[model samples]
Target: MGDLTFEDVTVRYGSRRRGVTAVDRVRLTVPAGAVVGLVGESGSGKSTLARAAVGLTPVTGGRILLGGRPLPRPGRAGPRPLQMVFQDPYSSLDPRMTVGESIAEAVARDVARGATARRAEVTRLLELVGLADERAERYPAELSGGQRQRVALARALAGRPEVIIADEITSALDVSIQGTVLNLVRDLRRRMRLSMLFISHNLAVVRYVSDIVAVMYLGRIVEYGPVDQVLGDPRHPYTRELLAAAPDLRAVGSDLAHVGSDVGDGTPTGSAIAVGADRVRIALADVEPADPHHPPSGCRFHPRCPIGPMVHPDREICRLTEPDPEPHQHRAACHFAATVETAPVTPARRSR
Candidate 1:
């Protein structure tokens, strides 16, 4: 396995006049033989960053490196050390070629070999992915969704890549099948000592596969650290919200009280009663989603932040300047992240 590093990477789409910045000066590293899980909601640039690692997307600024070496140009005449397993296996594989031929083709690209040798290599790759040798004869449409994805993995393995970018590979399969695929990937990573960037919206799935976790929001990493520290003691409000939203009954102390409210009559009403026995809520609903084109002045999340000046006094810094990613016990991008405990959540009601 090789080290994968994103050095201040920035990816923008369209022209300067009307463009969208997908990844903004993101700096992250995936060490050799380690699995890093990147989690975020839709449109948070997780997939964009993953594509950049494999040279599938153009970088508006910054560079991507493998083992401290710059990535080769796409059309360079050599085998690349990186491979990607995409979300839709059906679309990624060749419909015309059988599974065996596809894997053999990948082998041919990676190494000059005769037909018999290519077939032998394909058999070994299939066995590595837990597929029978004869299953290679099946077509993409003839096999089950799980089998197709397995074939995709087998093909990726044929390249002998140092790093594997797994982008929501099991997203299209059933839950049971997803588990089987995840198990297979975990086993293969350990046996091969492979480095992987596992990108998914499912926090649980990410937690299951990743040694390190990075939480992304609006094209920035809000929190990143070891999985246990980042997920168990989440420092970012966004991370807390994501974890709280997905409750795991089996996990100890995983429940969080819902602190949302409704908007009506120009007043926000909440579940918790406020002073004077009246129910008051922070106007989180009034906060509009940030436009990727314009963004906000200071913190991109301040508008939707439920706990700030409204909860604590003299917290105007949140509106005036953005907090750089700070490395304490965990890395977080919030000015009041340390003072978050003092911020109000549900105020008690006064007896009237």
Candidate 2:
């Protein structure tokens, strides 16, 4: 009953004629008791998917299901089946209401208990989030940044939701505090066996928190699979690029560096494909992504694909036809996924 499925879900903003397509037929599943991490750039629609799932944002096409049933509208009377822990805690919390009152309000949604019982439940929730009973008497303004974020989590949990969409809950905290919040989230998820959709731009954090990982670009899932498979040995060029950009502690004195000099003329501008480069161009390094309103003709990532020019079998096809989401070793939206998987690994250069 804890499965959260997105069946070809799509979300677009504005009118159909001039709409900006934010999410494009994304299909993902967060199985019961598993954390599925969604990682992407700012405009990549990670937050939009979370918002759309809980009915905060509009779902233009397809549907999101909870435990095999369609999600009910918000404020429909009963306990909410899904909840969200927002990125910004200060804005989400009411400055006027005492923390206890806020948690009590959510408790009252399901519990018919009197003030005494509600207070007990509030105290329990505060404890669950590692907050003290005394802090419950304070307003949102009195809490530190991390404490407020915990309150937001406690309030979300007060609904006893089956699915929690945690949208970058640690992005606003200091690194030290971020670790604390992450530890709390991991501990709580384990204790409650909660299903979660963790969204973040931090690859390292995503790697640590997720059982499954979904990588988004523009408005599409470019890759998704078990955390180790997706991040440890990524098949998508974008995923590879992202991993290469992240600092690897093991690469300090090793020859396994991914750095290389630019190989192409570097003259091509905009999001159009360049066919003249003889070697790999590290396309994403220089190319500007296409506007969402006018994505490329074929593959969405073709314009900025590092190996688009180097791969012969699928090169022309990638420029003319859209590749369906192929699930082999893992799910990837690239036509050359097979080739990428079988491609020989480049030898690590000696550190000079």
Candidate 3:
């Protein structure tokens, strides 16, 4: 069974005139001992979802369950069963506290261990994150970016949480250092049997660490499935676009320099229209443009969609109607997902 589940979750900020839904009806199941990647572009709601999971961000609607039971609201629940590793490690750590003290404090609060045991655990946690035991005596200001990040990770692990939400934890580090941290997290996962929700915009990193991948676009999950199936044979246009954006070393000097076409003006065409199936076709003409403050009527993607002459399959309605997420083994928000045939080459223009 999954260790965490998000059921019809939605999060919006502010009153009606100023409100924006950061996450919209998002559903996810994070299986125990598995690493799940939440991949998307900036403003795709990845961070918001991460915050919601640990009660850092209030849930505007819906429920979050841990071990099949509802999670307590923030503050009321004491320390969370889950921990988070922020993107900016330097800012996340305390400048005043020594690394050992920071880790020890976290251990004391979350693990309920005594001071002696906390000190011992701090030493082990620092080592587990690849920092030498002596480094623990240093302050955050004394450490390098990578070392500081490792310290932050150690503090998060001090809680021995069943789940860890790493929000772009490696994006700020050097490429060389990134690999080291990635390997450390992978090793720790195996050693501790952890369930992780890894959030990142880097597709390559996500592919490397995630057992399952979910692609988000403008606050909604456009595609979700096992990592191999979704990465190897992507079913959603947005997912394909993300894969295309990932740098491929093998194609360094090859003709496949560019992966997909650019959808300027948000108008989708060419490969965006899925062919070969009897699925309902929802065309772009039926809907209006997306407004961050007030999104368009019907399908959120319709203004940019290329498909034409298609009606809602289940309801026989026009593109002005919202379509439910596909009910396949893998899920997609597009109404015409089943009918769309993914092409090897996406339509985006190549980068020079």
Number of the top-ranking candidate, with TM-score as the measure: 2
Stretches of model 2 off by over 4 angstroms after superposition: 249-281, 309-314, 341-352
Give candidate 3 regions above 4 Å deviation: 109-113, 249-289, 308-318, 346-352
> Where does candidate 2 have its weakest 10-residue lDDT segment?
266-275
Which is the better candidate, 1 or 2, if ranked by lDDT?
2
TM-score of 2: 0.86
Query: What C-alpha lDDT values do all the predictions have?
Result: 0.75, 0.77, 0.73
Cα deviation of 164 in candidate 2 (Å)?
Answer: 0.5
Local accuracy of candidate 1 as per-residue lDDT tens digits, 1-352: 4589988899999988799899988888888998999998888899999888788898989989887899888878777788999999999999999999999888844464788788888889999988899988988999899999999999988888898999999889886677678778877877999899999887766766678888988888888888776766666767765654443412211111111111111121231111211112333435566888877767777766655554555778877898788856478898877754322233332232
lDDT for position 223 in model 2: 93
Please tell me which predicted candidate would have the highest lDDT against the true structure.
2
lDDT of 2: 0.77
Off by over 4 Å in 1: 108-112, 249-286, 309-313, 342-352
